[model samples]
Target: MHSRSRDLVEHAVTKVPAVTLGFWIIKIACTTLGETGGDWVTMSLNLGYLIGSLIFLAAFLVLVSAQIRARKFQSTLYWATIVATTTLGTTLADFCDRSLGVGYPGGVAIVFALLVASLAIWYRVEGTVSVESVVSARVEWFYWVTILFSQTLGTALGDWVAGEDRGGLGLGYETSAAIFGAGLVIIGLLWLWPRVSRTALFWSAFVLTRPLGATLGDFFDKPIAQGGLEFSRFYASGILVAFIAGCLLLIPQRAARRAARD
Candidate 1:
């Protein structure tokens, strides 16, 4: 029984997922889905930003609660929670930027600060912000918080860059995607460079990937005149969600510590 219990705990401590090409692919998919998903509820359904925020917020809270309470990582539940956060982050960011009139720059600043603070507090309490140690509930909470902020920031940055008329950097979605893709390449190189901080590189790439997905998502869903594919937000989100679900099903989900086990 003792050995069995230990095995269960070991399973719980297993790493979420390695920062690999596959991880980035799924993450960007989720982020793009987030953009379209949020817009569907807020714009298509005409629930309005406020109502949409409340709906997604509630879903986030519930799913997060379930995620935290689980004894071990369950792929279905975990990814569902991730989808919840991204969708909620999209609506929340949109609310702050448009309804509250914070604008893209203002929203970016606020969300960036929040992400930094969450990381600081996480490191102070947990002694490290590395994804490899996401076993304890406290560290897991910090992880989710940081993710929430990053997702929100990505929304603001995406909007800021992919607009030619909105005082954005005047880069079209394709250009913005390329720029962020280049940034990811740089970070990957740095990760392989001698004496570079792997942790720092990991976080940098993680945060950057969010905006990458956001921009591409907007590009696909926005109007053709605006250079997007003019896809329905709901349809785009649905397809992405289905894809993510398939990956989770086939990818063999495990805890954060599994890789560390000898």
Candidate 2:
């Protein structure tokens, strides 16, 4: 690569936050907030899934553009974009599962396939799917697209596990959340194994956290009849937002450093 081109790549690498414990903490909180905020707009406000998806999608596009234009990783901008994708994912999955009559299983299958396809293409084009390799606009676009698909798939999978009827597993919200949380723990343990791939483990854990957050969000907002606490969606979203803000303030976050060779 030319010197200028290499410099651009190095600059792009700094656009994303480093993967750390604090990153995961805020991610879970944001995903949970996505659930409540999505529900607030779709269910509480009577906007329905289709309309809710449109609104969040627009927000996602705006934030993503801003993120791409930024010179370095801005925690607020990056997290805001993440929240947008998750919220959009929530309503988009619900629309596919309910409005389109695909059912939870079908929605999960479709979105999962899309996620796989996106990653496959990304790898074929860029030669790597590691987050550390996201050092260009093209790679960044692939990263965000894959994330959107994973988030959508997670919402459907979470609903499938939590539902008591219509081909679901009959697990309540709390149980579903626990199951996903346990899955994440298993993935974390696997990361410690010498033969395991860190990139694979990272994506696995990333996908798992979404549904864990989804079920946990449902636990807070669903009705007692549905085995949830029945808290108001607006209040739940507010609390989660506050929690995320606090974590951002208390925890240190920095951009991932580029390797010696770009």
Candidate 3:
């Protein structure tokens, strides 16, 4: 029993990349791909939002299950799961906002509430929301659930701030991207300041990056009349995927060190 327990613990070590510059770069790229890829299936392919959501949700489930079953961090698997969540998030948000007639503000509120609830439940159950503590299956589940919610929330936020229709802010894609990018800069500065929680900052920045990527993706793929570059969603998704592949090959990634437990 003792030997088995030790082995289990050892195998449960962090199965995610160490938080680093490379991680952020690839994360942004993946989120951008999520937006463009989701659009390709739903709009370009004429599948519609509901179908797109179902397809991406299936991918998210499969990838997340694989992630949970893995014994150690596989960069490819981790990133594939992330991309799945983002793609699912994009279509899911669209369904909620447009299909359900909730509008962007309502969709944002719902997803944001879900995200907050997930974090609260995670902290209540695990006593911490730090990614460093994701050394067990239960904690890993919490982490991924929170990520999915946050990703969905980001899509709603991006649409609320940038969508030309649906009573959005009228900022257009590029300006919205710039604003979210500036928010990330502020978060970075806060990270350097003392008396601030690094974990909180990390999650905050993580959430912000999604919307930034979403807006940038829209800027690239939406029509010129819609204040976008009018590029093909398929081509945009392919380029972003190539960029992500290059980053994964060239940049270093390793599972984060396990945090000491009390």
Best of the candidates, lDDT: 3
Tell how far residue 184 is off in model 1, in angstroms.
Answer: 0.8
Give all TM-scores, in the order shown. 0.89, 0.94, 0.94
Q: lDDT ranking from best to worst? A: 3, 2, 1
Task: Point out the worst 10-residue segment of candidate 1 by lDDT.
Answer: 253-262
| Model 2 score (lDDT) | 0.88
For candidate 1, write residues 1-262 as lDDT tens digits.
9999877765556326555666677788888888888889999899988999899889988887888788766767776777777888888878877888877777778888898999899888877777777876777788888878878877777777776543567788999999889998999888778788777887788778877988888887889998899999888888998899787766655455532321
Q: How far is candidate 2 from the true structure (C-alpha RMSD, Å)?
A: 2.5
Off by over 4 Å in 1: 1-12, 258-262
Q: Report the lDDT tens digits of candidate 2 across residue range 133-173.
A: 76677878998989899888888889899986556788888
Stronger candidate by lDDT (2 vs 3)? 3
lDDT tens readout by residue for model 3, 92-116: 9999999999899999999999999
Q: State each model's CA lDDT, in order.
A: 0.79, 0.88, 0.90
Question: Which RMSD values do the candidates have, in order?
Answer: 3.4, 2.5, 2.7
TM-score of 2: 0.94
Model 2 lDDT-worst window of ten:
253-262
Candidate 3 lDDT score relative to the true structure: 0.90
